[model samples]
Target: MPPRPRRRPSDRTTRARLASVLALCLVAVGSTSTLPPASAHEGAADPAHAYYGILGANALDLTTLTGTGVTAVSLEVGWDRLEPQRGRVDPVYAAQVAGRAEQIRAAGLDVILDAGLQYPPSWVFDVGGDTRFVNQYGDVWQGQVGARVPDAVFNPRVRRAQNRYLHRLSAVLDDGPIAAIRVGGLWYNELHYPPATVGDHRNSLWAFSPTAQAQSPVPGYRPGQGTTEETAAFLTWYLEEINDYGMWQLRHYRRAFGWRPTLQLLLPGWGVRPGDVDKAVAGGLRGATRGELTGALNEGLDWAGLLPRAATVRGHNEAYTTWVDAADQGTDPVYESPVRHLVRLAEPLGLPVAGENTGTNSPEEMQRSVDRVHELGLTGLVWMNAAQLQDGRWATLDDYRRLLAP
Candidate 1:
C-alpha cells in the first residue's frame, strides 16, 4: 500500500506536542526510582537564625543578600591590589573599599573584611627578596613553585610594613560598617605554608633563608629535603613563625580598631587524628600512615596559642575536599564536620566559632555543609563565592536559608 502523505502539523499542535514531551521528561526524572523521597526533617525552612550570610568579591549587590535573610557579608581586600608599593597604601583602592563597606553597612548587614598577608605586594618581596623562603633544593621559593608568601614574616621590617598598611586601612575605613576583620595570609587562604607538592609537582620547603636558618629553634637545622626529623623540625619552626606572625597581625588589628569591632583568625581544619607523634616521626613518612602523619604534622597550628588572641575564631574548611554529604556518608557528623578538631579547641576557650565552605561545592554538598554548621553548634555559616549560586542552585540556597532561619 502507498504510504499516505503526512500533513504538516499546525503551529499550535507542534507547541502542544513539545510541551507534552517536556512534561513526560520531567515526570521520568521525578520518578521514585530516580530520586529519593523527600523527608520531612531534611531541610525545612526556619524563620529564626542567628546570622545567615554570603561571602563575595568586589561590589556585592546588597539587595539580593538582604532579601535572602543574609545578615552579613564577607569580602577580601588584597594587599597586592591596595598597596602594591612598599609601605605605600593606595588611597584610590582604600576609598573603593571604604565605599563598598559603607554601602553594605547602610543595608543593615554586618561586614567581614579580610586582608591577605600571604599574597602581599610584589614590592615587599623586592624589599625583602633575600628573605623569601628557600626550598630543599636551595631554590628560592617564588610563586612559581608554591612558595608564594615571602618568608619574611619573622623579620621586624616586614612586620612594620604590614602594620603600616593596617594602620592606613583602618584610617580609611574608619567608622565604616565592619562587624569583624579576618586576619590571615596563608597560601590556601588560612594559616599554613604551601604544601611540599601541589599535586605531582614537588615544591621546595619554605623559610630556608639564612635569616630563617639563624632563627630556627633546632640548631644545625638544614632546610633541604632529607629524613623525617629534619622535615618535622622545619615544619615545627615554620608553624611557630607563622603562628607568631598571625598573633602579631591580630595584636596590631586590635590596636588599630581600638576593640571597636571583633577580629577573627581563621585556622584550617586539617582534621582530628590523635596519635603518637614520636612513633609517627620515628616511622618515616612512608611508614607513617595518613592518620598518624595528620596528628603529628598538624601540631604546627598551635590553636592553643593563637585562638586566645582573637575576639572570635572561625574555621574555614574547603567543602569540595573536606566534606562528604550525609547521603554519601550515612549521615555521620564525623564525615561532615570539616573543622571538628578546630571546634574542639575553640569551644573550651569560650570562643564563638563560625564556619565557611569555600571554593566550588555542588548544590547537594552545600546543603549538607550548611546543616553541619548548625549541627556542630557553631555561630554561623558563610557560603564563599556567592556568585557561583546563580546556576539554579536556589533550591540549595533556599534549603540553606530555611535551615539557617530561626
Candidate 2:
C-alpha cells in the first residue's frame, strides 16, 4: 500500500514503458480508434472477469485467495497504508503490492485495485481538528468538537491531494501490470445519515472534518447543526460532490490514457430495520429493508448508461441475499421491482453490470442470487470473503469459474 520504492536507473525506464503501455491501452479503448468495441467480449471471455475476487477481508488471507483458484483479487488499499506519514511512503508495502500483482499476473489472474478514502492518514484528521463525533477509526468521542468535518472528496485542497496520490499510485502499477481500477466505494455512507448524528456512536459521524464543512457549497451550514431543508440540501450537494469526484477521476483516466477504467459503487446493507445487528442493513419501503433500496440505488445510477464510455459498471451488491432471505420468512411480497428496474436500466446502456461483493454462502441462496443476476441480465459476479471457500459454505472459486467458463 505504500508508495513504490526508488528503482535502479534501468528499471525506471522499464517502469515508464510499462506505464506507457497501460496508458495507451486505456486511451485506445476509450478513443475512436479502429479497435474492437469494448463490449465485444463477454465477462466469461474477458480474462479480467474470469474469477470472482474477494475484498480486503479475504485478501489479508493470501493463502486462501491463492489456493481457491481465484483468478483475480480486489482489496481496499487505505490511504494510510500507502502513505503512512505526511508525504512519506513505506517502501516495503509498495514492494509487496508490486510482488503480489506480478504473482497474480503470472498465475493468469487479474487484479482490481481500490484506492479508498475510509482510512486516510492520521495527519488528515488533525488539519482542521476532529470536529465530527466519530473519528477516522470509526469511534465516537465525548465532548470533543470543532469545525465540521471536511468533505475531502469535495474540498479543492483535499481533492487535489487525492488526485496526486492516485496519479502516483497508478503510475506505479500502470506499467507494472494490473487489471482494473475501482474509483469509488460505498460513497453514500457518510451523506445519508442525519447531520445531528454525524459523529454519533452508531453512524460514522466523526469521519467528517472542518475542511469538508467549511468548503461545503450549502449556505449557512454548521458542523453539527442544520434544519430539515438544509439537511436535505446538504445531502443532495454531498451526493453531487461524490458523483463529481468519481466522474472527475474517470475523466482523468480517459483523457490521460484514452480509456476509462471500470467504476464500482458499493450498495448499502439490509440492516436498516430496528433490532438488525448487521452494519450492512438500511431501511426501505413497506418494511422491505435495505437490500431492496441498495439495488434501487444501482438502478438510479443507470449503470448501463456508462457502457459506451466506461469499461464496466460493477455494483458491490452487499445486501442481495442478506435482507431478501431474512424477509423470506414472512410474506413481504418479496418484491422483484428493484431487479426489474435494474434490467430496464441496463438494457439501454449496453454496458455490462456485475455484483462485486456478494457474500452469500448458502448454495441454494447463491444459486438463487445467480438466477436473479441472470434474470436481470448481469454480465459478471464477484463473491467476497474467500475464506468462505474453506468453510464449504459458499461456492468455491472453481464453481464461479465453471459458471463463467466458455
Candidate 3:
C-alpha cells in the first residue's frame, strides 16, 4: 500500500471581498450542507484498503483485468441514453444499464456509475430558458460532445430537467451492486466550463449566457471587461456558481440514491498556459478583454475553493477520482503538481482521493502515473482506458499489472 497523502499549510482566512457585489448573485440553490454524513466509504484514507480498477473496462478484454488486481469499473452511463425525453425514464435503456452492471458484477467487479449528467437530451434544449452557453462572441456552445448540452448550472429550467434525470437514474441503481456515483459536470464528466475555443482559444469565458447575465452579481459588469475590482468580484461570483453546481448535483444524488453509495467527482488538472492557478487573480491572459485568466478561471475551477466545500457533502464519503493523466513524473515543479495537485488539496480535507490515467499519454508518462497511483495512499486508481496495452504501446499489460501486484 502507498503512504497516505499529506496536506500542506494554506491560509484559509484569505479571500478578496469586493463590496460592489449585488444581491441577485446570492440566489439560493440546493443544499447538501444539512445532510447527515452517511458516506463513510469503509476505508476512505486507510492505505491497506486501496483498490485498483479500470474505467472503460467494458471496452478491452474484461478477462485481462478480472484477475489482475483490478476490482472496479468506472462506467459512463450517459444521461442522454437513459432518459431521452424530458419526463420519461426509458425502461429499455434503464434495463440496459442494470444489465451492464450485472455483467461487471458477474466478472467479479463492482460498478461505479459515472453519472453522465453532462449528457443533455435534445428535448431539454427545446424547453429552453436561455439554455445554451453563450461565449463573449455570442457563439452559443453545444460543446464538442454530440449532445445539445444545456447551461443547467445557471439555467433553472434545464437544471430542473437534470434534477429529474438524476433522481430517476439514481433510483434505478440504488439497490444494485453499484459502488459509487462519480458526480459529473457539463461535458467530459469533469466539473468545469466547456473549453471556450473561440478567438482566444480555451481562454474564452463562458458565463455570458442570457441566464448567466441576468443573474450576474453586478448588473452591467462582465468578467475582464470591468474595473480591476469589478473583474475580481465577477470572477469570484463565477467560481462560486461553478462550485455550487457541483454541490447541487451531489445533494440531488444523495436525495435520490440515498446515502448508500458515495458521491464523487472527476476534476480536471490545472490547464492554464502559464500554469499558476494564483494568476487567476493577477496575471496575463490578454484576450478581446484584459485580466482574462484562462484554465482554472475560464474553466471554472479552483480546488482551493472546491475541495473544502466538497467535504461538506454528506460527510467524507465524497471522493476525488481523477479523470486526468500525468505527462511525466509530476515531481517536475514546472508542471505545478498537475497530477498530484488535486490529491494534495483533498488529502487534508479528509475527502478520499484517487488517480486515473487516460491511457493516451506516452508509455513513460503512463508509467509515471502508475507510480503515483501506487505511491499516493489514495482510495485507489482507475485506468480510464487500456488501448495503450492493446496497441503495443507498452511492452505488455504486465507493465501495469506488476505495479498493481504486491
- Writing each residue's lDDT as its tens digit, candidate 2 over 106-167 gives 65666766665544555665545332333323443332111222344534555555666666
Residue-level lDDT of model 1, residues 311-360, one tens digit each, is 34333211111122222211222221335444544555566556666435
Candidate 3 residue lDDT tens string, 23-86? 1112221122332222222233555567666655445556777547777876667677788866
So what's the TM-score on candidate 1?
A: 0.72
Model 1 residue 164 CA deviation in Å: 0.8
TM-score of each: 0.72, 0.58, 0.79
Q: Which candidate has the top score in TM-score? A: 3
**Residue 123 lDDT in model 2?**
67
> Which is the winner by lDDT between candidate 1 and candidate 3?
3
CA lDDT, every model vs. true structure? 0.53, 0.41, 0.60
For candidate 2, the lDDT comes to 0.41
Q: For all the candidates, what are their Cα RMSDs to the real structure?
A: 14.6, 14.6, 10.8
Between candidates 1 and 2, the TM-score winner: 1
Model 1 misplaced regions, further than 4 Å? 1-49, 144-147, 198-204, 219-235, 269-272, 284-299, 302-336, 393-399
